[model samples]
Target chain A: MVSRRGFLQGGAIGVAGSAIGATSGSLVANALNNTAAETATAKRQLPFYGKHQMGIETPIQAVTNLVAFDLKPETDRSSMLRWMTLLTDDIARLSRGEPVLADPAPELAIGPAGFSAYVGLGKSMFIKLGMESDIPAGFIDLPAFKMDQLEEKFSGGDVVIHVAADDPIALSHATRSLVRDSIPFASVRWTQSGFAHTPGVVKSGVTHRNLMGQIDGTANPQLNSDDFASVVWMDQGPEWAVGGTQMVFRRIAMQLDTWDQLGTKSKEEVIGRKLASGAPLTGTLETDAPDFAARLPNGLSVIPDFAHIRRAAPEAFKERIFRRPFSYEAGISESGSVDVGLLWCSYQANIEEQFLPIQRRLEEFDLLNKWTVPVGSATFFIPKGPEPDSVIAQALFS
Target chain B: MKKIAVLLASVLLLAGCAPAGQVEISDAWVKSGEMSVEGGMTAVYGTITNNTDKEVTFVGGETAIAGLVEVHEMAMIDGEMKMQRIEGGLVIPAGESAVLEPGGNHLMLMQLTGDLMAGDMISVKFDFEGADSITLDSVMAKPAEGGDESYHETEMDMSN
Candidate 1:
């Protein structure tokens, strides 16, 4: 029988060998096992230090642990600084395949697997720290929506830590390390774990389908493009917040049982996209601009006015957001219904200018809203990436 | 000539030639504890690097919040895991590090003067043999897991 230790050692060797093979510009000629190639892809390491936080612009990983923390009553600015420093140290070490300080299970940290951690501060944090005046321009609490069934348990927090990795074990270890270091200054408000396709399971740049089986985020700006920078990174915020962005997080629960009852044609009309290709009703390609004014034989618009894509479309040049979302399944609900949904996360330079307008339009009238409910909502300001040896949001403390 | 060369080598070693550094600590933290009617206890964990040529021994430590401190290890006694105080100090080889971690070796603090709540920081001065005492500010934290019950039990197997 193959021992656990032997299997682990073999996996590690396979990963290293595959990495060397890939870098040598030669097709791996069946010499390395398939498990080794897949393992190497899963073990890709993302640099922790950069112009912006790693997870925001970096491609989404396979698994995510989104944890929110509410600061303790006794926590003050100085204590918060210490907490940030400790968390920052942990992130830097864990992202590079090293164990955090005093880690009880250092062995679990061996596989970084494209690990990245993004830190964000909620509006309540400013009030708690007595820095409300320094809150970035256009960063505010999201207005209550008409379709919201918001629960306090998953609604708000003083701080948010978003950690992701392609490997679940690596993600779990990193998440635990950060949460362990945080309890000293804060209490956990909520934790939501979500996931996507494994690293090598799908082609690299394809849009992911949500729980509803509809291709999501097809309208998102291309990564690293100038359009992405304008839509996702702030340039006119407070000096300390420059290069940072605003995030709107919502837990949108899907009513799939009822949604499945609708006819395919009706579903297509509701979303205004083809089920097979995600292309607009009036276009053959997913990237084609939808011809909103096209008419059919009955003199009705091909893309229905109440369609989700039509309603969510930007009316002006600046009304846009960069979406990076994940799918979540929490098993069955207490009522014996399947519990699954989308953890919708969007980044924008200015929430007021970009995100709110589209959301308001959707709230006013979107056919797809009948099958989706906003159950939890929160907003945060993700500060710029920290320099080497510095903690996240160090300028706030100064 | 041989005697003169030996004396020269001894002089060089005594004149700070042995790595030329002092002991340092990093990632130091203390587990949170409450002060009940009886008392309170916690443990400190971190990495201690000995940079000097001679081996350094961590004898004990002093903190304003704790009345007593000692080096401890978790060992199996009578087929059960038990906490025990190391009679001799924990030693670190020259230019090497000794990790004080949970479920392993650590520094125990007992008879706390007050509650060591989360978000609080306490100063600890570590006494060492063949080195100067180093003071560090350790944050009080409550880890999610990792043998936390042993620290709270307060029963030490001193039979050894």
Candidate 2:
């Protein structure tokens, strides 16, 4: 399949000077220069004003800064509205490559590079704002799981911002702009920066691999498909949250040292998929449906019962959640172990119905669990996108 | 001077047309004074578009939250970038814009009555040369990233 990113790249290369001598060294050099120029000058942008938030359904960017903020004691509904307005203006301007008002380094604001910012409200936000009754049903905080060793610093916040861009400079500027604007109303609780392969490095539409080397997000609902809309967008909720969804963000650390001890066969058995092609044990392609019932000559299932994929599979069609994950590396730990993990984010219309059941299964029994630890977890209710001339969650404020 | 002659000729030509239009300000915002104590300072920024056929001069402005206001500019003095008061005013050519931005020409508000928290709105009345005064509501906001350099280096003339 020609992925959207591939098509864009193809278009870009096609428009450049002709490659008359296709195999010539000079042609290759010229092509490389053109690609470099394209990466530098392409002002990619994602619209900030839309029916739903941009980052939710938008293709993943090269880098992300997931920041959570705790509201100050004095913050009230009125003050929250003001903060949202300020953030909205900042996001809108930064997404379009325009500097926010009083931007100190306006020059750094250039090149939006597909920049987008998503805002979500935690359970505490509604409580503190005296709007607990307005919290969308099924948007409660996740119950503690047996596999969790969640840290307080990374766990909870009143608000969270997911800022992403293809270019690190644009992402950094946008994140700083929003965080600085939030100073009066909130304080930074934690920040987790994650990255995927740089744009153009990976072929478009290829599923991203986690730090564990397993192809991730293989079973995700196709973007813009009806299945995705139903699974990821809220159609039944309070007026303020009709187009919003619930996000379950967990920082799962990988035990790469121990995982590396396993041979290819053991790793495949643990994940129920080929590490190289990401194909299920019973199939040849990543997109092929896993045949969980397929039996071996010894009468054992092709995909082991405790395999990660098997345990994570949805019991019912309604239980599926859309996953948009990124890998994070925080350098070596105190013990000299590599501190790397998956910043797993799953979006669903109802977290209770779609996400928890699958998570419960994984927590109970997944062979891959031995090599992964959940260290940080939080759930947030992302509100509907703002209308023109209004801030996000304007309905809730009203 | 040729510049003065052209200015006079344009004024005469505009006088023959319909009455001059109003000066408009947009994207108006003021820096939060939260970091500063009472009687401290902040700056206002926006684009002042002169829709009038004649040139418009922004002399100064006043806000209920500030004791004094002045037009200031960031200029390259010697080899260093320095902030100084614009002596006369900022001129916006007819149908052109004069941008009051950080690291550029701005309206400086000094002797703040109290801390201007983010999200607060202050009404500022702008005084113009040969035009009616315009009042606008500027939202208070913390400066965007990298916007603090000028504030740290500004050599304010407190006596003014």
**Model 2 clashing residue pairs (backbone):** A104-B146, A104-B147
Per-residue lDDT value at A34 in model 2: 82
TM-score of chain B of each: 0.77, 0.79
The local distance difference test score of each candidate is 0.82, 0.83
TM-score for chain A, prediction 1:
0.90
Clashing pairs in 1: none
State residue A286's C-alpha deviation in candidate 1, in Å: 2.5
Q: What tens digits encode model 2's per-residue C-alpha lDDT throughout A42-119?
A: 477778787788797877778899999999999999888888888887888887788776676678986788788989
Q: Is the docking of candidate 2 incorrect, acceptable, medium or high quality?
A: acceptable
On lDDT, the leading prediction is 2
Instruction: Residues A1-398, candidate 1: write the lDDT tens digits.
Output: 98999999999999998888777645445545566865685568888776687798877788898999999998888777778777777788788778876677888986678899989999999998898998888898999989899999778889999999988899999999899889878999999989888876766542677888887878889988999999999988666688899999999999998999998899999999987788999999878889999999999999999999999999998999999888999899677788889888999989999999999999999999999998888999999888774568878865
Q: Each model's fnat?
A: 0.23, 0.54
